[model samples]
Target: MGYLLAVAAAVLFGANGSVTKIMMEAGLSPAQVTQFRLLGTAIVAGLVLVVVDRAAFRLPRRQWPVMIVLGIVGVAVLQATYAAAVQRLPVGIALLLEYTAVLMVALVAFFFFKEQVKTRLWVAIALVLVGLAVVARVWSSELDALGVVLAIGAAVCLAAYFLIGERQVAKTSALAVSFWTMTIATVFWSFVSGWWELDASVFTQPVDIGGVGGELVVPMLLPLLWNVVLGTFAPFLLSLAALRFLPATAAGIVASSEVIFAFAVAWLWLGETLDVVQIVGAAVVLAGVILAQTARAGKVVDADLALTTGPITTVRDTAVP
Candidate 1:
């Protein structure tokens, strides 16, 4: 169930990038989209955090800096950058790059965090590379440089998210970390958004619900609601939980399913389809990620195999990538 929940979370989380694309098309600015995600996530995740960890919500004085940084670099940067990337590239292509966080985290685990890797892992990564090559079609004549750069930037943000989130999981419950981190992210994102640029108009009501703080005032918020609920709220909570046991890198590979989901969702909802060359390119990007994910902890002990493996031990385990 935990693994299922984690994968489900990855889907929701992964889909957010595509969701942002839809919202933007509906006439939301990048900053506006980010504002909704950051604030909406804060409200949803914050409520859950308060209910689950009300007793432990407050951290010591020293932890505030850590929380603030995590909020800015991890949540804010990741979501904002991803939104920007999808605005330019095909959803599947953009996603293929960003999900490379799995590889980035794996490498970090090896040389920095020092985690283990097995031989089969390398083979899997190699397959990923081959698959991505087929998907992206590297030999193609056309190249979208701007799209590629934005995608790479998104991946960088995801890498930061993994590294920072891993650090917090050690001392905090996933719920607590997610809640506080989200709250902080929302706050920072708001500051970046500037109060003048934000308005209630960003959220619209095509229909009405019952009542709220005053009169009957429910409105059509499917796009916005999904943004808050499935995209922002659910993903953060589940990922925070996953971070407790899974290393950032392994979590990343599993999360790579997001790439598959992105393509599927984009096609289903947006009627977008990938051509052969694009598919090949996407495969190549994923290939790099897999290679990084499966690489071993040691330097160069070249024998018969590269001996690539994923993280060993629980969150408790650490080694060179």
Candidate 2:
């Protein structure tokens, strides 16, 4: 059930790229879409929390600082940057770059946090870097430089999202954490996106509902609602539910499958297909991601053991004492 939930979440997240791109092509800026998506999701999640767990509304004052940072940097920045990258780059390529957050988290743990990690992490990092080069086809100069940069920025923010979220969840329910995070993100984006400047009638406008070559058309509000409901809220809740039964390591690896799903969905829906070499590169990068997930699991176990057992000591002067 946990595995199924995780895969379901990945499917939703993977499908979101094409949906977002469709909206972008129909006359919405990435920022506007992001603002609406966050605000809608926050409202829905907040309502759910009110009915299901009213106590979640009572957040501790101490959590405000980190939660604010998570809202601004992790949620708002990450989503906007990813949306921008998707608009500029192929959805699959943008997602591939953003998923490098797993690698980023491993490196940060080792260096900044001074955590003990297995040597395999370095090998994993190397594999991902090589795979990225192959995917980018560096010699061909086909990829957009700005898109790649934004994707990398998204990766950094994603790493921070997971790190901060792990801490936040330790002290609160995942539902509560998600609600507050989305609320904060909504507020932040509302100010930055200048959402008030958007015309209200735009939501009722007929827009293209598919990719560049697509023929389907729908009201703009439909896909926007889908973005909020299926793309963000539903998948997020599923992911949190999956963590209840799956180990973090297993869940992380399963979650990484979002890249494959994204590529597949884009290929089918948007007619964006990668070359054989890029496909192989994506596979290699996923392999490295799995390896890094294992290393992270080991690091967590090591930390737990150290905390529980303490440092080893010898009884050298216990003869007469």
Candidate 3:
């Protein structure tokens, strides 16, 4: 059940990349796209929390600072960077870069946290480095410089999201955690998202939902609605539910399938294609993700806790209490 839920979430998240790109091409800035996503997630999560657990609405004072960081950096900034990367880069390539967070979490656990990592972790590191080189074709230096940088930025934020969320979920429910963090992100982005300046007419304009050169036209608002509901909220809940049945390590490995799904979806929907060499590189990177998932020891601090965001990578909490 856990594996199924995780994979389901990955499928939605993977498809969401192209959906997000479509919205941006329709004239919405990355920040505006992020604003809509975050705000919608917050509202939906808040409503669910109200009926399921109203007590989650009241967070302790000591939790405020950490929640703020998670909301602004992990949720808000991470989504913004990812949105921008998708706009400037192929959806598959952008997602491959962001998924580096899986390796980042493993390395942080080994070095800073002094966790007992498996010998295979070193092998995993080598595979990821080599695979990324092949995928990038760094010899050519053809991809946009800024797009690569933005994707890397998203990786950093995602790493923080996993590390911090591991602890937060031990103390609170996942729905509550999402609600608070997304609420913070929505509030933070509201001031600078430039949403007010967006002309209402843009939403009414026709957009090509078919990225494969077909003329499947729809109002821009349709995809935007899909982005907020099916793309973001639905997947997030599935990931969180998966944690209930699967150990963190197993969940992380299954969630890593998102990269594969992302590449496949983008190719079919947006016509993003990769060379033979790059395809092999992607396979190698996926093998590394499998190794990295098992690198760190699995310790369930709280059996009831389900710690994950939309992207369901897991990390051991190394912070001294």
Best by lDDT: 3
Rank order (by TM-score, best first)? 3, 2, 1
Once superposed on the true structure, which residue ranges of model 3 sit more than 4 Å away at CA? 299-321
Question: TM-score for every candidate vs. truth?
Answer: 0.74, 0.89, 0.91
Candidate 3 collision pairs? none
Give me the displacement of residue 153 in model 1, in angstroms: 1.6
- Please provide, for model 3 over 1-321, each residue's C-alpha lDDT reduced to its tens digit, 9 standing for 90 to 100: 877888888898788899999888877899999988888878888889889999999899988988888888888888899999999988878888887776787788778879888898899899989988888888997778899899999988887777776766556666788788889989999999998997888778898888886869999889888887888778777766776777666666676777788889999998989999988988888788678767777632221121123322233433212
Candidate 2 per-residue C-alpha lDDT over 15-49 given as tens digits, one digit per residue, 9 for 90 to 100: 88889998988888999988888788778878998
What C-alpha lDDT, on a 0 to 100 scale, does residue 57 get in candidate 2? 93
Q: Rank the candidates by lDDT, best first.
A: 3, 2, 1
Minimum summed lDDT over a 10-residue window in model 1 is located at 302-311
Instruction: Evaluate model 1: give its TM-score.
Output: 0.74
Against the reference, the lDDT scores of all candidates come to 0.59, 0.74, 0.78
Q: In candidate 3, where is summed lDDT lowest over 10 consecutive residues? A: 300-309
lDDT of 2: 0.74
The prediction achieving the highest TM-score against the true structure is 3
What is candidate 3's local distance difference test score? Answer: 0.78
